[model samples]
Target: MCVRYLGFVLLVWFTGVLRAQSAALHCGAPSLSGGYLVPEQETYSHESELTYACDNGRKPAVEGWWATSTCQNGKWSHEPQCIDEKACIPPTIPNAKYTEKLNGWYEEGHKIRITCDEGYEQKDQDATAECINGIWTSVPVCERSTQACGEPPKIPHAVIIHQEYQEVFAVDSELQYECEDGYTVEEADGKKSIFCIAGSWTKGPTCRIRPGTGLGGSTVGGTHGGHTTSTGSGTQPASGGGGIRPGTGLGGSTVGGTHGGHTTSTGSGTQPASGGGGTGPLTRHVSNCGKPPIVPNGEVLETNRLFLKYRCGTFYKLMGPETVVCYSDGTWSEVPTCRVAYCAVDTDEYPDLKHAGVKYIKDGESLRFECVDLWLVTNYSEGRCTDGRMTFTRCCNKFQLNTNIC
Candidate 1:
């Protein structure tokens, strides 16, 4: 299709003298399925169809691309092209093997058959995967079968208190165990035991104890204590329990972000984010975006909110907003970044472009493109340089090579 279009374009250019004659305007051939559709005769006159019947494995790249051309005055009505059936790479499936009779490449209409190995089952009932365009429509899955618990798990520093236990136990069996000296169950209502159930084992309790004291605590879960013993002037009552049971006098311990918002114990109930009728001031929840996202060649600004502002270095202008706000939900808004102010123009787009410009331009500067000779700007031939990004629009020989219009 491209060759035929180029041929017509070249013919029209060579027959420049015939432009004044009553010759039909040529149509640029468009790529169809994957084949070429040239006119039957050189006389591209009125109504005609550049026809070609594609093979079984091939189909049109786009819907209803076929069109008959009718020369309305001096131009052809439609572009000529055909669709090409491209092949798709085979998909990889875990624990599944493809059938031996697989083709080298799965064409558009081809199908791939996969079977799960022994002791494995398909994720879905569909065993056949189709190749649509360059991607596989869908792939089957195979996963290992799950079974009940094989043996009773042994606990560290503790033994099962229940007697009716065996090597291999049934599912959903709840066992009882107690922690030994210097150690105690941190979670599970302050009890030491694990339930025989899927998805819950991953969250099994840990034997925890307080630091410097026998009582233990796990810092993995929860935040400010929900129900506290008290709320002193310097201590803030925690709403999210940091551990299973509240330890003794957790005074001067700050919660949330590291902005000096400490919580104290004075035997009290829960406190809200704002004023909660307690002697302790409203604990400001600082935004902890984890190792604040760094902006290239930029410095962060000081702000009491969850987020910070970033500004580019000298000679560099900000590409986006400068301020990042820290929200009340213990999260920070998206951080703005800075980049180099150097911008480059793509000269390959304009075949007949002429300019005495360098490869890169300074920030906030515009490049001039001469609109003389065979080059035509049609009112535009300049581009601005900002944040290492260039927006250029240049026209050549009355044709738009590349432009950033609108």
Candidate 2:
């Protein structure tokens, strides 16, 4: 039989007939089984069925249509099996190494850790690793550890007190010094004792005081002149001196009118006996007369004739014949006169006086006036010098008497 349906051709024949017939079909080979015939059309035809078997120890394929042979009598064709096409697998990080790979079936946010060996230090990320493509992006590096000391101690003029003598130092441990005997020990600038924190001390010394001489007296006692002597004896000379005869003076000679012992004068003006050496007067002759004069009560001593004069709170030497007499009150009798002893007179004279008594002028001349104080002369500028017959003008304001005049 021959049937055409939807442009596809199907050949119908018995199973045995189809097996024995040698026919050529274009779309696909014809299938004959029992009374039914199934035609293999182009759309449904299996060209060359591939049998699928997973390699590399992959999961086995499922049995149904994907695994069952398709042809009825002829050799059944196997179907292609479903495979895992995912190329990305979680990247592995070696025990001590870190990975940055991101490829994996793991959900996002998966992480891993990486670390270094005992003496080594991790240079890269030591905490977390990320999943990326099938391979890790980067491997972490491990390096050797480094040892270092902190800043050196700030001590000056002092040495560290430790066996190591390292640059860094701790607190509470001290730095020592070597000072002279009399001087005291003290801390150096900008430094303190080391603690147990980070460093140790090395070596240090202490301060001592220096001996000296001071203005205060020495420990041993002596006089300011540094001399020591016994009673009735002079101080020993710094150099040796010859011994003198027992009762003799400086020259070892017999004294006085007697034959042997030294003699010293006891009277105010007497000299030592001639034959014995004697110390002469060491002072000059001074008279108390030239010193300030002592004034006795009711008596007057004229200082103008003497050498010294006394005034208010001061003593002065008399340079000329100015008289300064002493009074009963120990004060000078005369008021201090400011006038010079000698003076020359010119043609100009003093205003004329009209007093009847004698008028003495400072120039050592005297005249008799008929008028007294406040009286003016009638002759205007000149006046008669008579015994008692002088005429006068009336008193005026310009010729008024000066009450304070001495």
Candidate 3:
């Protein structure tokens, strides 16, 4: 008797272990390029689906900006990929302008027409300017007319890049300039652009020494307390030093810096430290939830920093609230579950039941069952499905009229 009891206990324990393992099945995180998946997580439960959003000028391999993938037993049903949409940036032609309004970036195979300025003509009238594979092809060139502006003026500390050899430049012709080492053009963002006007070229920008060098009179250092200070009260440096004019600071550098740093310097001459490397202010958390939680067999319909709405898949009923609120601590309200809304029956167990081979009966739908030739059932002929379950009033064999055989 004791041996039989021990054997039964072992069998029950093994079944419980197997049930736990099957219930906890999950898939590892999936990776995507040129885009990111929503509701990112380290692991996802079985049969869970996720949607991804692509970056600009790129689309998922499947279709539009958004695509979905499902996590099967241990692998992804579809691997997500974001591919280049093959869009081209607007092309610039010297002494000419596009006829249509430039829409920033043009899709593949898009074409644009150029109209030369008053005193210029296209070098190749038959050339077609079109976008192909994210590049412009056969761009029209506007040749200079007899009545044109003189050669472009040379800047003191700058040189032309990819300068085309031309004796004369037409009105509205433009050129790109690059400043020498240790020097930067005034108000120029990396490239110095100059264009010809009615009869003369635009004023060329001057390049001055870059700040933060130990050789120049300007000194940039961090204080003992780990804060950077840029003072502009000192006298101007000699012509060799690349200091700013009387009261200006380095272009684009903000005083005090970002990430909660504070600036104490006065006057417009003050600026942030070079490279923004010095230690600054303490960081603080923002009151916002970056991503919403993933819902199996469901999707997020509306999303915001503090709230979101969820919807379940077809034939699945939601068991909790449709909307969830995010707290300041970044935790969300109780998430809902998408409960199955269909009833399934075993065909092998009830061969006499009519349509027992049917896959499933949707919620609120009815199904009829039959017994064997000599057996009869009362109130078990028709049953309605509900919430993954089905009920019948009675089940009995022909001889056991008063007993429920099932």
RMSD of each: 29.1, 51.5, 37.5
Candidate 3 local lDDT, 10-48, one digit each (tens): 999999998877756777777788899878999889999
- lDDT: worst 10-residue window of model 1: 196-205
Q: How far is 79's C-alpha from truth in model 2 (Å)?
A: 27
Q: Which structure among the candidates has the greatest lDDT?
A: 3
- What's the lDDT for residue 307 in model 1? 46
Candidate 3, residue 165: the lDDT equals 63
In order of lDDT, best first, we have 3, 1, 2
How would you encode candidate 2's per-residue C-alpha lDDT over 321-375 as one tens digit per residue?
A: 3344432112333333222222221112334433121121222322223222443
Instruction: Score each candidate by Cα lDDT.
Output: 0.50, 0.31, 0.60
Off by over 4 Å in 3: 1-287, 304-306, 355-358, 369-380, 393-406
Evaluated at residue 279, the lDDT of candidate 2 is 44
Q: Write down the worst ten-residue block by lDDT for model 3.
A: 234-243
Flag regions of model 1 displaced more than 4 Å.
1-291, 296-298, 301-307, 312-321, 325-333, 337-343, 355-365, 370-381, 384-406
Ranking by TM-score: 3, 1, 2
